[model samples]
Target chain A: MSGGGTASPRHVITGIGAVAPTGLTCADYWSAVLRGESGIRTLTRFDPSGYSATVAGEIPEYTASRYVPGRLLPQTDRMTRLALIAAEEALADAGADPSAMPPFACGAVTAASAGGFEFGQKELEALWSKGGKYVSAYQSFAWFYPVNTGQISIRHGLRGPGAAVVAEQAGGLDAIAKARRHIRSGTPLMVTGGVDGSLSPWSWLCLIRSGRMSASPDPEAAFLPFDRRAQGAVVGEGGALLVMEDAERARERGASHRYGEVAGYAATFDPRPGSGRPPGLRRAITMALADAGMAPADVDVVFADAYGVPALDAAEAEALAGVFGPRGVPVTAPKTMTGRLLAGSAPLDVATALLSIRDGVLPPTVHVASPAHEHLLDLVRDAPREQRVSSALVVSRGQGGFNSALVVRAAA
Target chain B: MAPFPTFTTKQLVDLLRECAGEDEAVDLDGDILDLAFTDLGYDSLALFNTVSRIERDYAVELPEDVVGEAGTPRQLLDLVNAGIAERV
Candidate 1:
């Protein structure tokens, strides 16, 4: 794909960081991504005893004391710990300090569907095993609501404005969308992204009850989004953080910008279970393009929200055909490598899309041997493809009827 | 896709030691929650982490609700024994 023209209202990504199965930092994650390394492994975090789902994408050998200092390690859950680590990396990468910058100018936001389930499960297990007497007091705060955003804010000393968006899978992209709005409205620097760590026994049980988990035991065979034999999506755990700043602020700071801007963001709701494909998400894509002042033809690549479910895959394909026409857009789903990070999924895609725009390379969607649907969308597989991308459209949807689209542009 | 025998108490102690990552002497007859967890310095996070390791090693799902009824070490042993029975 070649660039048609330049995109406008560029929101610069000055900092990118994450604590993921690929790696502990954005540099490590990006390198692993380029090499196409798989992080999925057997369930080692807990005994799956009677549970059917056996595999997961888990962060290997993560210790909070290594990333976060000794003092704050005990107070935060693993999910928050990952978020803080990523945020710290991003802040350091951006070379911005809230104290050095204007007061009330730096704020933070995070996307999260659930926080600290591993911690919650442990406490609950204690409660059940010991009749509440052994339930640790720390569970109250460790399992506190929106703990990721709170921990990130406290860790970074970011006090401008903080919020946690809850849209299940779309939370990450929506958080970035909100951060872009924050940067546009008033705040100079807004840190945004999402995190999830729900692989604990209780959490895993809950997800199993939700009936969305892929039952395939083999990691490679599991989570084949947009593939014919795709069962259901697998669960992965991690967090990614981005330091988004106003284009003007970014330029003034002399920060090396990766992408042009978060030009537009639009979300739609698709209520009613088992409804045919996501027309709501398709409308969201069109709306986001309109918000970015671009057309479907202007979008060079598409980071697809391939949910790995047959119904969802079909819906998204139809929606893409309707929006971008039968010619189709280049679509890639990298989450197939890490399973779905739930809330963290969309932000990772957003980051991937931004990186793609910056480097003029399309990351491949692995494990997809064939296009699951008849739709004409170009699903890049196996290897990276060269593309002169000016604008990229990233679409994401959550199971609970939430859909969102974000437009990212190449940095001039 | 693998199976292992139901763990004996000695095997469980060894597993617990390996899972817990420390040499805190466990009271096998005492409260599993308090002794194996709190009093033994294993916090909730650590306990869950240990449980996750156990589940992976055993390839079993210790039902959250099933474990809730156990408090004493004997009770936990019985719970694990029953889970292993059901799976086998």
Candidate 2:
């Protein structure tokens, strides 16, 4: 449980940067979440009316030029630009200067489930309308899944061990788990999480192919997780990035605050259909608590993956029911405010969990008035639950059955 | 057919400025014709996009390695003008 055969350094999240649909910064996003404001509305990026699902959780009033250098604008995708902005905000919030740190002491690990779909769609259009040569050379790396890690590393000069996870929605927690590995393996800092977008028309076409996106035109009715009206997820863009620093290093560097500690993490995969084995979420939850040297009762709140599909929602409810029993724990899904953000959503939930631990309030699952799983879940709806939150468990299940659980607790 | 408009040094400089965007730290308008693109803050990727822009804008295709071959604005201009001449 230690790094380099020494005592395991406590890996704590010192800073957070978020670019969710509801808000642009960590403070703004938290405020919007607490207010129960929904960012889901009609898609203005294009005529999404032509598509089955018209509403989306696009980041409001975002201009990449304001955050990124002009030189990087033409080369990077909207996804990477969003990540760069978040990383900058995170480093600034953590007050850790990578340039001032030792060589190779910092790293970055990000997740990307939909690798620059907007950028790829643009290039594909050029190829179709004109020719292959018209495609931007930047497309080579921009559309690739790991470019977020590469861009963040390059931007922040994080030359330490770096990686990118692509396990769909589960990828965020998986990415954070990877960051913990580096922190435990002696790396001092990691800028980790997932920010993803594939919101263009071409990618929209591909998204519906999964049969998981909600086709409802009404924004309020589009995503009703744990409700009978639950149709499917409204795909969203934007996520969060957090600065995870070793405890001693954060203290030595005079970091202003510790958001929380990454107490434990575990990931599992659902058994394929027709297999006798059960879904892995319950096991993941149990194993993560054990890793944190805590029990299920110790968790204060549960941030669900909240796949709005009825069967998936029921399965998640069943998982929570199995772990904490029906109505044993308070559960919420603020993503109802900002649809599901693919790989980015889980990390957003994790960030929200840390904020919950910091502020001692549980953000609500908005828009789901009637709880279909009231017998199975103490779903925190409509109002912020003002309770002391010390530790939280974030549960996420990616497309193709990737399941992950992460435990974040207040610093001891 | 008349050769595509001559790819002049001024034109290349204008394109480079447009490609990389006019940044305050590095002046794309200075005496940058002989200086390496990297020295001018235009990395390989920037050069790639500039080259791609040149191709699409002028409708004259240069060799794929034109970017690799042209390290400076002058070199890029030479390659682009040659491609323009070949379009005659």
* Model 2 RMSD, rounded to 1 decimal: 2.3
lDDT of 2 by residue, A44-131 (tens): 8889867888999988766767788877777788888988988998999998899988889999999998788888989899899989
Residue A170 in candidate 2, Cα distance off native in Å: 0.6
**What stretches of model 2 exceed 4 Å from their correct place?**
A1-6, B1-4, B17-24, B59-65, B82-87
- Indicate the worst ten consecutive residues by lDDT in candidate 1 chain A: A1-10
- TM-score of chain B alone in model 2: 0.85
Models, CA RMSD each: 11.3, 2.3
Predictions' DockQ, in order? 0.03, 0.54
lDDT of 2 at A153: 92
Error at A86, model 1, angstroms: 0.6
